[model samples]
Target: MKRILLRLINFGKKLPLVIKSIKKIYRYGGYTAINIASINYGEILKEKKVLITGGSTGIGLSIAKKSLQVGATVVITGRNDDKLKKAADEIKNPRLKTLKWDISQINQIEEGIKNTKLLLEGDIDILINNAGIVNSITFPNVTEEIWDKIYSINSKGLFFLTQTLCDQWMKEDKVQLKKIINISSQGGFVGATYPYRMTKWDISGLTQGLGIKLAPHGIIVNGVAPGIIATKMQPNYHAQEDNVFCSLNPLKRIAMPTEIAELVVFLMSDAANFIVGQTILCDGGYSIK
Candidate 1:
């Protein structure tokens, strides 16, 4: 009897959501599966050169793949040489290139950017600062070593890399518009004491600042803050192949890396040129919940 009553209460609570969904379906002429036939491969990113950090796996890898599919020359950088090679093999595209770079090492920023430009034999038109680390350590449990480690890659490294690239672009007297897409996390939108979330806050702020500061120079800075994505960063979510469910999420499912990649591709293309330093939250309503 108790279990039955509990189920009834839960059903009652979800009734509004169900009704809302039904109304949306009916109003929008019902839902349909997104088939390949419906997708238009217009190659919106053609003739573009892109560079993605932490591109050997997960979200970065997905973004790199999509960018290449849209006819962009892509260069992916990772800390591991083996992983970079493996990603290159998986993509199997002549326009895809890989560089072994550790973004945390500030000393290597200039050299890495120079080498990447040399590999492309041209200036990078789009730079995606997607390389970041996360930890759950909070409040009293956080240590200085851990904080430094997270900030080095997530905040400091990103700042210098963007500055170096902008300086180079300015010196070259390039007339084409440049784009920088920093990958932050949905955790940034909340009040959290963890180092990872704190670093993400920094990313969100930097995106706005750089977006305004660099606009006069034909550079647009923006960011994507994804929530509960199924990636190695979220081990529990990534392990399940068929399971996309997430009870905590309002949508009842975590986002896939491909979904975030699509948003990134749009931001990189000319379609989003007018969009300034705003970090779009691709959290599937998680932040609001």
Candidate 2:
């Protein structure tokens, strides 16, 4: 039977693939091992300096962990000092540095960047604009104050932060591979609400504009729009047993914080060099529905 199976598989002389039973005993040698999704990127980001905003919790903290796993030097910033200290202690990485930064305040932008650079001991090689705020109010309830608050942090602050980094990178004599990853939302793609949705749309546009302009300078700009992720930043509507949020999407479950982090790690990799200016949505299928 073994001989017959081998002969049948090899019968196709020019077939692209020919596989015989692997568990069967082999006189020649052991079966050729195949590994899928086993590529080790642990050292892909070695010696890379990364700055992440709102790294105290939720999606931002997750990205910081993934960056550290990939052997990158990371500087995380947030407004809350206690949360920052807690996060730093939990991670316990010598390569990790925490700073206090609030993206909404444009006046402090230079100081914040300088602080991160000092902690990193060099210019930032990567920037993850993951700090964002969203309100649950609907279109009718949307007010100027609410709109201003959301846009100030989510849209305006994000753009200016990227702009500052871009300006500095453009001044360099030899531009290297720099990354700017903006965290957008599914609301940007679909017609959901008013202010929060409007700000996200700006993020999507900003990603494209920057990607095109920075292509010549080796700065790859991209965005990620995630749907209902189970995180402190966003409210959880249903309990684990109910799984209402998950059912809304085709995947039958809301995304975990770590799941979204995986996508972020991919965007930061060298393999994603060509995926510029595009804001990829990580929403399980909520938008399509």
What's the lDDT for all of these models? Answer: 0.88, 0.82
Cα distance off (Å), candidate 1, residue 282 = 0.8
Residues 141-180, model 2: lDDT tens digits? 8888988999899988888888887898888875479999
Candidate 2 overall lDDT versus native = 0.82
Candidate 2 C-alpha error for residue 94, in Å: 0.9
Q: For residue 172, what is the lDDT in candidate 1?
A: 74
RMSD of 2: 12.0
The segments of candidate 1 whose C-alpha lies over 4 angstroms from its true place after superposition are 1-41
* Number of the top-ranking candidate, with lDDT as the measure: 1
TM per model? 0.86, 0.83
- Residue 8 error, candidate 1, Å: 30
